[model samples]
Target: MTTALLPPATDADLAVLREQLGRPARGVVGIAARCVCGNPTVVATSPRLPDGTPFPTFYYLTHPAATAAMSVLEADHVMRELADALAEDEDLQAAYLRAHESYLADRAAYGEVPEIEGISAGGMPTRVKCLHALAGHALAAGPGVNPIGDLALARSSWSPRRCVCAQPGAAG
Candidate 1:
């Protein structure tokens, strides 16, 4: 049997990743990225200090769909469309806000809500799930993990690389 070896990290690679991170979200309203399975992952990109070392870090978010979707430009388009829809339709935005507010209220009342972290400013379910998955993956991967780290490693920005939902058509 043969085991696949993981690639080593490099400074040049980190630099390229940082450049990609610098780009602004092109009209992405509510976006999330997650591993197919459902592990919270983070992507970070920062310049190295005088010592020429990268300062990569990762954080937790609550949107698996957005997170996972971000992997592909096509999925990103879906997020963009959702954002445009929200911007154009006040009723839609209001509905999303109401749902999110209700979710938050319920959480506050219950003192615990399952998978509540993924929900962002709007009540986007896939995006929220992706964020939560990313956070969970970051915790499991380690504190040093971040957006840059994930990009450098070519791992999913939202969730663990080996997700159960990581099927070909799993992403939305």
Candidate 2:
């Protein structure tokens, strides 16, 4: 089942996101998750862009601080550790498999692209490729959906419980 439909994004959100990433947003459909400060943390994007290219990444992390936190985890080689955990823990593997399924189901709700039919981001159900993707899934789906995402959230400096909005260079 689709967990929950995200709230429609406001023009304010688009401006903030553009400022956060230092570029314009493409194919954004809704705000998947938001920080305590009311800034969008994760955005749900269209499976296919206006350019007609199939974009597989559905949940996109957009907050500047959250992205920086995930980047720090990636730099620390956390993906390798999570991959190892996935390999050794059957329960974890099962849960991660479920996460993969959920991700795919979520994407399918919008539209399907044959090229990305079975693929899920962050090396899901098999490996931990990108913390940003996993973290996005975690934020959008909330805690307990993705174990790795939970772990990353727990271990990282960033927390949705806290607000890191409007930092030094974040756009208005």
The best candidate by lDDT is: 2
lDDT of each: 0.33, 0.87
The stretch of ten residues in a row with the least summed lDDT in candidate 1 is: 24-33
Model 1 Cα lDDT, one tens digit per residue, 1-172? 0111123224433332233344331211111233444322323211122344432111223333334444453244444544455577666556545444433332232223233343322224223223233333333244333222223234334334455334443321
Model 1 misplacement above 4 A: 1-67, 73-75, 110-172
